[model samples]
Target chain A: MSLCEKNIFKSIFDEWNQSIQRFIQARKIAAEDAADLTQECFVRLWKNCHKVSRDGASSYLFKLAQNISIDHFRKQQVRLKYTGQMASKSEKEDGQYLMEMQEFKERLEKAIDGMSEASRVVFVMHRMENYSYKEIANQLEIGIKAVEKRMHKALKYLSEQNILKKR
Target chain B: MSESEDILLSKWLQNKLSAEEKLMLEEQYDLESLALILERQKTLEIQTVSSDQLWDQLDSKLSHETKVDKNQSGSRRKLIWVALILLIGASLAFLLLAGSEKTIQSAKGEQVRHLMADGSIILIAPGSSITFNEKDWSNKREIQLEGQAFFDVEKGGSFVVESNQGVVKVLGTEFEIWESGKQMKVQCFEGSVSVGNLTGAEKILGVNDAIDLNNQRFSDVYNHGQLEATFKSGQMKYRAINVASLATELERFYNISVRLEKIDLNKSFTGILVLNDLEKAVEYLSKTMNWEYDLNEQNLIFSSN
Candidate 1:
């Protein structure tokens, strides 16, 4: 990490490093993957600490971590494809796993794309940027109450989408 | 309509709802809402970034810009809004976040005493909160709060309370900040507190001084008397006032029935009592005022009928 990046990470470390860790874990990402994603989140925050407007901080980091998780899953798929063919369980199990991953990614993408801009920003900031209502409000120049309303709407919309429907 | 459901939803969404709101929501709403909300949040999260592409781009760009540090530093300080992000992921911080070792909790009416790894203790008041990243203790001692909390921070290094209103920065001091509703009040009990608004205006509140915030401005000023009178009393103390104001407070405190028919509505009392004692307190008023009282299970009538 560069000095700027280190400082950014350090600052984020001071602010919400815990919150991001919780978010990734809540997503059920494994321990090692969670750590990598957390580190990656800081790196992203450090690198882009200046480019995007401050309002984008929470949403940006959240989006970064989410994207990292997807990448981890995608890499896992390649590994599974090569390794599973030989030492595999039943064909049904393999098919089921692939189907689940595809469904998970698809539902997630649709939800993000479908969310209202304000709601999406709120959700992303809360989830990825690890920002609270107060921080989001400060970043966006809105009231903390407003930040809260957007978050509620975003989560409500996401939940209504049935993205986490069990198989 | 259930407060519990609202709380569960807010918790699921990671928003700040009051404890009463949380309890009401959880008690009234179905748990399915909680599960569904969590699930959707997860799904939405998984779809946001694709990964490492931005990093590769930034890597080459940063390598080329050697003198960007000074430029970025000046700009970064401008976005001090980022300081308030500390309260997120309390559960995650405990379960997965790195380098936190202390469990700090502020109860519903009890201010929690927080001893940071850096030899600092924050006395976070009731209906208020604070959490530290125990994993990162050596490098940073950060705390985030919701509602009003006080800090008697021991000296060593920088400690900050990031609230919805603004940042209360402390090198080391004692202060109480009550941030509830539209107003944010910061009172300096000892030493000095640096209060900064997001618009980048900063004010140093000295011992026994306070600043009230409205429209993002440190606009109002008060001394220790006002701060102590308001917060120290815990509840608003009304002395022999009209029934209307007392009733309003009564409604909040005890949820009792207070009906004044054929009696002086503006009649006042003399003794001072807390809202918590509305029942007995009001009864005492009735006797003093020479009024006949009818009590029927949670409902009280004060009149000559």
Candidate 2:
């Protein structure tokens, strides 16, 4: 790439590559695989930079990373099928596994919705809301022990109900 | 199904269990409960919403953002619309098949623009429908239609248009087609075009040739046969058309409203006039007929006063 194109690519990569790296880490892809995938995403973005609008570039990069992840898994599935060596689960097992996953997701949402306002707020802040426990404790004006206790109670109640497992 | 085991499983699934508690649960809980907890955790990781629900939220945000006064609003509106569209597009990608073959229809006398994949544009007229492979559009710029539209196709590989009775194919072109209720007319105003009938037989139309279809018969019309050229040629008598008929003609021409006033029933005014502006068209008609007219909000009132 020319210097200008490289600069544009570098700027875009600099802005959104962190999210891709987070996605890699969140998905628990191996460190090497994560690096490879992140690099592949940048290369793809550089290749298609002309067509992608710069305004929603973050979303575009994320979507590209997502597609690459799907492709990676699909390739892994094919390889596993040929070699008879499954990494985590067979593809059919994964399908049933996904169905179960979706059921659990629905139940989890319901459970979260049913949580008491204070407990729900505390739990969401610490978990899905991505706030530190200390931050949540400070924001809610509650003691750290109280926040942790509520989260523990919330999870225990959810698990005991087995609402997700029943699905 | 032990109560203690369920409690431990829930804690583990919630990620609220401490390191020691997690190990204890994995060791003490049955395999099934452990599997259930893993499944629950995986499910909690994804964000899924129905496309309609997501679109509703996005549309609300967009409408709210665009509702500001029209001064500093132009660029803001565009930016918000682009953001809203991109966000909706990405989220929709996550829950891919939640919306399938969904078609939204416009009310009578409405014209709307649909932004499709591949950067192509389709402007659908009132009572028209454009259907395509929602999934396939990711790979191809192809649309199947039933009714009428003006396409400003993106410049790329061949853009195919398949209708009930025929098929139209072109790389990139700006053209209008009306295909409903005993009418199928493809007017190629720019670029090259190739159209085929349902019989797998096709004909390629050049710059000015239009295909006029009557049920099974499709005939090609050259420049002289089209009404657009006559209007452009400044032939007043040749351009003269029925007033009631002119409303429908002008509707598609200017893509706006035209209200006929109290004039002679059969008044056929003949002149080469620009139909770009409805206000201007009313002015020209009023001048030619020596009638008076006023632009009242959206309505153009014409009288002999």
Highest DockQ: which candidate? Answer: 1
Query: Which residue pairs collide in model 2, if any?
Result: A159-B10
In model 1, the runs with Cα more than 4 Å from the true position are: A1-167, B1-96, B99-105, B226-305
Candidate 2 on B50-92: residue-level lDDT in tens? 2344334433443443355344466887888889999999888
Candidate 2 CAPRI assessment class: incorrect
Tens-digit lDDT track of model 1 for B21-72? 6666566554475464444334333221222443444345555554576676
Q: Give residue B222's lDDT in candidate 1 (0 to 100).
A: 62
Clash number for each model: 19, 1
**Each prediction's TM-score against the native?**
0.32, 0.34
For model 1 chain B, the run of ten residues with the poorest summed lDDT: B42-51
The Cα RMSD across the true interface for model 1 is 14.0
Which regions of candidate 2 fall more than 4 Å away from where they truly are? A1-167, B1-99, B102-115, B123-129, B138-148, B154-158, B162-167, B171-174, B178-185, B189-191, B196-202, B211-220, B224-245, B249-276, B285-295, B301-305
Task: Please state every model's RMSD to the true fold in angstroms.
Answer: 20.8, 28.1
**For residue B155, what is the lDDT in candidate 2?**
77
